[model samples]
Target: MSVSKLLSRIVAHSSDRIDTCKCVASSLHDHTYGITSDPLTQFACILSALIHDADHVGVPNTQLVKEETETAKRYKGKSVAEQNSVVLSWEMLLRPEYCDLRGAIAATDAEWTRLKQLVVNSVMATDIMDKDLKGLRNVRWEKAFSEQDPSEDAHVTTNRKATIVIEHLIQASDVAHTMQHWHVYRKWNQRLFEEMYKAYKEGRSEKDPSEFWYKGETGFFDFYIIPLAKKLKDCGVFGVASDEYLTYAIQNRREWEERGEAVVDEMIEKVKAVWEEEAETTDTFVDEASVSL
Candidate 1:
C-alpha cells in the first residue's frame, strides 16, 4: 500500500537472496552472499526502494509525455516520473543536512561509486513499462545467467549475477501488489484504475482507462507480471518468497480474467459517484456563502 511496504519487501527479498546466493554464486563460502554480501549493496537496494516513488503523481509516464509537462520535458519524455523521483530524492540525500548520513552510508570514494551505481540501477529498474528498458533487461538477464567462460574471474561472475539480481529484485518489489494475495491484488488494482480514470476525467490522458483497463491488465499479467514472478522463482534466490509471488500472480491473473470487466464497471460508477458528491458539496458551499453575504 505504501512505498515503505515495498521497502520492507525489498529488505526481505535482499535477505533471502543473500541467504540463497551461494547456490548461483559459484559455490562461494556458506557465509558469503555474493554482491548482496556487501553491506553497501543492501543499503543501496533499500535506499532505492525508499525513494523510487518519492513524488509519483498517480499518473503514468506516458500521460506525462503526452501532456508535455515540465517534468516530462525535463526528462525528455522518457521515464519522466522515475527520473523526477530519482533527481528529487537523490539530491535531497546529497544535501548538507545529510552529510553524516552520507558518511555512514559511504565512507570511501570507491564505496560511494558502487553505492551510486547500484542505487541508480535499482531505482531505474522500477520503470518496467518502458519498452527499451525491457529490451535491455533481457540482455542483462542473459548476460548474467548464461554460462561464463572458465577464464573469467570468479568475482566478476558473482558481480554480474548480483547486478542483474538487484535490478530484478527492485522491479518485483515495485509491482509487489500484483504478486500478492487476491485481496491485496484487488485492492491495489482498484486503486490503480481509480488513478487512471481520474486522469482521463481531467483530460490529462489521451485514452479512457475504462475502455482498455480490463484488457490492459490482462495483457500486463500475461506479458510482464507472470514472467517476472517466474524469473524470481527460477533465479533460485528468493527462497519461499518467489514461490509465493508466482502463485499469487497466477491466481490474481485468473481472477481478473474471470471478473475484471465487472470490477471495472463497478469502479467507474464508484469514482463517478464520489466526484458527483464533491461537486454537490462545492455548489452548496457557494450557495450558502452567497446567501450569507
Candidate 2:
C-alpha cells in the first residue's frame, strides 16, 4: 500500500534477474549478486531495492541543496533525499510494530548487519547523479574488473567483482523503465517530464522542461541509459536478459529520436489542460464562497 512497500515489491522482481554467469561464485557471493544462490545476499539486495526510494519528494537533490531545505541541511547537501529515505526507512523498520517482521526477514545478528548495510549501500548507489559518487563507482568498476591481481586471493577477487556488480545491478533497477518495454519507458519518461515541468511552473527549476525535453531524452539515451544497459550486459550475470534490456533500450531510444517531439507536445498540452481545469475549479469555489459570505 505504501510507496516503500510497492517499490520494494518491484525491486524484488528486478533483483531476481541476477545470476552467476561466466564468473564462478565464491562462497561470499553465493547468496546474492551474481550467484543468486544465498538467501542473505539475495534478500538483502531485495530490501535495498525496496526502500531505496522511500519518502522521495520527487525533487532532485541539486534543487534541494540549492534551496537549502531542511533535509539538505540535515545531510550537508550530499544525497539529501537519499539519506533522508534511508534514515526514514531504517527508523520505520526498527520500530516495535515491525519487530516480528524484522525477525522473520533477518533472523540472526550477522544477517541483520548484512541486511542493514546492504540496504544502505544499495539505496545510496541510486544517487548516481552525485559527481563524487559517480566518480568513485567508475573507479571501482575499472579497478574491480581490470586485468590484474594475478596473485590476488580468489575470494578477494570475487568479492571485488561482486561488490561492483551488485552496485551496477541496483542502479540498473533504479531506472529500469528505460531498459524495459518502450511503452513502459515512455510512461515513466513522460511522468518525469511532467514532474520537472511542474517544478519549473512552481518555481523550483530555472528552465522550462518543454524547451529541452526532446533533446534531454535523446541525450540521456546516448549518454546514460544506453551505457548503463551496456554495463548490465557486460556484467555477465543476467544471461540473455541483459541482451534483452540493451535491445529494448536501443529500440526505445530510436523511437524517441523519431517521435519524441509529438509526444512532448502532447504531454505539455495535457499538463496545461490539467492546470487550467484546476484553475477553473478554484475560481468556481471562490465565487460560491463569496456568495455565501
What TM-score, over all chains together, does every model reach?
Answer: 0.85, 0.87
Model 2 residue 138 lDDT score: 89
Most TM-score-accurate candidate:
2
lDDT of residue 113 for candidate 2: 83
Candidate 1 lDDT tens digits, 1-293? 32234323322334334446445343432213364346787778778888888899888898788778999999999888888888898889899999999998888999888887888888888998899987998987887676557888877776777777778778887889999888888898888888887887888777888889899999999998999889876666665677788999999999999999999899888988988998999999999999999
Pairs that collide, model 2: 8-50, 19-34, 20-34, 31-38
Query: What's the alpha carbon RMSD for model 2?
Result: 5.3
RMSD of each: 4.4, 5.3
> Residues 1-293, candidate 2, lDDT per residue (tens digit)?
12122222222233344466533334223423443555666676677777788888777999999999999999999988888988998899899999899878877898888777877777888898899989998887887766677888878877777677677777877888888888898898889987887889889999999999999889988998899889867766655666777899999999998899999999999988987998899999999999999
Q: Pull out the clashing pairs in model 1.
A: none
After superposition, the stretches of candidate 1 with alpha carbons farther than 4 Å from their true spots are 1-33, 289-293
The per-model lDDT (C-alpha) reads 0.78, 0.77
Residue 101 CA error for candidate 2 (Å)? 1.6
| Clash count per candidate | 0, 4
- Residue 111 of model 1, lDDT score: 88
